[model samples]
Target: MKILIKNGMLVTAERTFAADIFVEDGKISRIENPGTLSVSAEKTIDATGLLIFPGGIDPHVHMHLPTPAGFSSDDFYSGSRAALAGGTTTLIDFVTPHRGEPLKEALEKRKAEAASCLTDYAFHMSPVEWRQHLPEEIKACITEEGIPSFKVYMAYKDSIGLEDDALQKVFYAVAEAGGMVTAHCELGDEIEQLRRDYVQNGQTTPEYHPLSRPAELEAGAVEKAIAMAARANCPFYIVHVSAAGSLEFIRQAQQRKQPVFAESCPHYLLLDDSRYKGSFEQTAPYVLSPPLRKKSDNRALWQALSDGTIQSMGTDHCPFMMEQKRNGLHDFRKIANGAGSVEHRLTLLYTYGVLQNKISLNRFVELISTRPAKIFGLYPQKGALLPGADADIVIWNPEKEKTISAQNHMMHCDTDIYEGFKTTGAPEYVLSSGHVVVENGTWKGKAEPGRFLRRKL
Candidate 1:
């Protein structure tokens, strides 16, 4: 089908224009004056007063993820629902190895499970089983599995974390393949030691989550990882950096002209450790690695994001329901980690950051959409709204005020962490590959429209 979007301001990473976007066969065919071009469309949209931007791309999210806390609250079907409702057209989730499972097997299993996504998506290989055959497996993932990015964690202990040597091996392999290696930089041994001390002192509350994983541990890991990446001459991306010290490490690395970059999440940018109130749902929800930092660090994160030290924004949307989050809360170690915010990322950024003048609207588009596509190698096709690009677009109402509630959330989760948070911007119309999947808060598409995308080498 052919569709014409009339009279909308087209916004891209670098420019904006008042033009009509013509989409044919799920691809943008033209962007021109309303009447200067003559074309017939099966459908026409009168975007009388709206800003049209490339669809948001959430580069980091965890859906249908298997963890000790039962499972990640959202599977593909529900996660895509939440993503589309929030104006994100593409999501790159992780497919990491579980205990005793080959990485390839884990990836294939996830592929089978997510056979019904409604948005375009991709996977980043998370390497947990770092073995003798790990290099070949990484090569196979890039050459055959369509994943050009691999993740290694310095935290998470035996579950997913790799030792420094293992991390170096993965880095060397990915670097040789011209792929990116992202690391979760937090010292596991230090955290475990702190946890032992905390529990020994009977200080096992949810608030201790941050105290257990201090800034120095994160910075130490960051410094070590950066040095290792430099030695291997590999491109590195630090994931969800939180502390001021860690940011400084990244800044110094970039200053030294290392192929090093980092990303910070909204939780780190907008929220702080002092906000933890002991409620498992609230406390455990925010209990991610490189835990929330002090208010001073929050501002630093924003500055990093603004100055381009941080290349992109990612949700890290890993949700565990209320019950799971509360499990063993008195012990803190067994309290499930992660929260759901995939559905609110775009709107929150627009309302709080862009509208409030923390960043420019165009920068918002770049941070959330264009930059991710470019860095992770999904650009041109999935990140922009230009002619010959995929018809992945979002028509957002920048003035709409709405309270976020899981009552209407589509992620199949029982709760939303952003509940009661008021926001001014929300996605009103969404198109994925030329199909209008969401219009006016209602979903309007099939379950399997989404396809897994392989990165271009």
Candidate 2:
């Protein structure tokens, strides 16, 4: 199929231009003036006042991801439904193994479950408890499965956090394989100690969650992880960076020209530790690691975003219902630690952050789209709106104003963290692979149209 999008403002991380886009068989065929077109198209859209951008590529989310709490909050169908509504076209989520399980088998099962999603997706293999045989598995993931990124946690006791020795071994192996290592930086031992003391002292509440995982702990882990990577001569990526102290650590590493990249989430930028208001709405609903920091940290996060210190922004869209969150109420340790922000990622960044003058529109595009693709090796095929690139594009109406609510959300989950948050920009038409999936603010696609993307090395 062929489509022509005429007279639109074309936006990218690098530049903006007034041009007409011609797509053929889902790849961009030409980007030129409208009158320069020579071939006829099956469809032509008049985008006089709209901004045409490459569809968002959110690199961190947890759909169909397994958890000890039983299962992930949302499945592929529901999660992708929400992703489309929010203008994201691709998501790269974690695919880690269960205790004593082979990494390959776990990835295969997770892939089977998400095979019918409604958008393009990819996976990052998380190495939990590293075994001697795991290096061979990491090589296989890169050479065979098309998954090249490896993740390790520095927190989450008994869940997936890797010990320092295990982390070094994995880094050495993945770096040798020409892949990037992404680390979840937080001090597990200190956090565990804090949790023990908090429980023993009867300090179990939503507000106490952040207090338990202090900023110093996160900063200490950041320093340690970076030093480990530096010593191993390996490049690494920091996941969900929250503290100002950690940012400084990353900055120093980068100044020395160490191959390090930092990422932050919208939750850290938009919400604060105050979200833990001693209520269910405040506590369990926002129980992610590196718990949201104070309002002062929020300003530093925005500064990091504006200055290119943070390479990419991802939505860690892990969700659990109110009832599910209740399981962790009496024991704050058991609370399902995640939040729902997949569907609100793009609009919130635009409306509240970029449009509000915290960052430029081009910078916002980089954070949500281009930079992720470059870092993850998707590049021209996934991130840019240019000739010969895939036609994963979003036509946005910048003047549309609406408040978010669970009543209107597409996710199957029962709550929305961004509920009642108003935004001015929205997607009006979305096309993935040259197929119109959403038009005129309504869905026009099926649930299983999405295909899995292999990691590019």
Candidate 3:
């Protein structure tokens, strides 16, 4: 199929210019001045007043995740639909292996589950336990399976988290194979002790969730993880960096010229601990891991983003229904720890980051799309609008305004953390692989599944 998008202002990480984009066979075939080439197409879009951007890439999300509270609300189909409507075309989800299971088996299982996705996707293989043969498995995943990144958990110690010895082994193996390691940084033992203290004192409400996992503990874990990765000589990535102190650790590493990258989510930058002061029902939705920090922390994160200390912004879009959250009404610890924002990430960033003058249009595109693609080895192919790139595009209407509500959202979740928030911009149209998936805020494409991107290191 051929698609021509004419007269739109094309945005990149460095510049924005007026041009017409021509897409053929799911790839960008040409980018020319207005009316430079008289080419015919199956469809033509007049984007005279819109901003053209390469589709957003969310590098951290968990769809169809299994937890103690059954499963997350949105599966691959619904999650991908919401992502497309919100202007995201590619997602990278974690493939967590079960206890004693091989990484290869886990990868196959996740691929099968994501077959219903409507946009391109990739996986970051998780090494939960270190065994004698696990080093070989990590090598195979990088060399044979085309997975160049691995995830390690410093929290959730009772289940998926790894001990220092195990984490060191995984880091060494990944480093040897020229792969990067991403970590969920939190001091599990300290958090678990704090939770015990809270429960023992009869403070078992949802408010205790954030109290047990404080910013100081997160900073401590970040420091420890950096030390371990440095010893192993591995490239490290810290996911969901929420605290101001954690940023210092990352900054120091970068000052030393370490290959350490960090990402902060929208919730960490926009919301704060005050959300936990509401009633249980109101507060449970914000009970995500590495819980929201102080408003001061939010300000520091914004500064870090502006100063280039933080490289990208991801949604960490894992959500559970209200009924699932009700399981922890009394204990707080059992409350599912995630919120839905895959459908609101772009709009919220635009309204808060760009409109508020916190960041520039080029910085916005870099944070949401370009940096993620480059760091995760999908650059130029998935994050650029140049010729020979995937024809995943978004036509943004910068003047449109709308209020966000779960009733009008495309995600299958039961609630929205940013409900009632208004946005001044939205996607006028979205294209995936040269197919018009969303037009004028409505879904118009078929249910054709997205391809599994085998990334390079």
- Structural similarity to truth (TM-score) of each candidate: 0.96, 0.97, 0.99
Clashes of 3: 0
Tens-digit lDDT track of model 3 for 128-228: 89899988998899889889999999888899999988988888999999899999999898899999999989998888999999899999999999999
Error of 2 at 39 (Å): 2.9
**lDDT for predicted candidate 1 compared with the true structure:** 0.84
Where model 3 places Cα greater than 4 Å from the true spot, the runs are none
lDDT score, residue 32, model 1?
Answer: 91
Candidate 2 local lDDT, 1-457, one digit each (tens):
8998998899999888888989998789999975677779889888889998899998898897656575767888889878987889888988878878988899888888888778889999998887879889888999888899988999985778888888889888888887889988889988999898898898777677899998889899999999988877887899899988899999999999998999899888988887788676556778887899988888998999998889898988888887877777777787877878888888999998878999998898999999999999888889899899889999999998989988988777788878789999999888887888888878787544677787675
Q: Which prediction has more favorable TM-score, 2 or 3?
A: 3
Best by lDDT: 3
The reply for model 2, stretches above 4 Å from the true place, is none
lDDT of 1 by residue, 1-457 (tens): 7988888888888987788989998899998976665799988887767889899999889888877779888888888888888899999988877756777898888888778888889998888856777777788888888898988889877578887787888888888887889988999888889999999999888888888998999999999999989888999988888888888889898999998878878878778887567566556767666677999998988888888889889988888787887785788888777777888888888887898888888899998899999988888998898899999989877778888787877777777767778889787789998888887757776545698999954
TM-score of 3: 0.99
On TM-score, the leading prediction is: 3
The candidates, ranked best first by lDDT, are 3, 2, 1
Deviation (Å) of 289 in candidate 3? 0.7
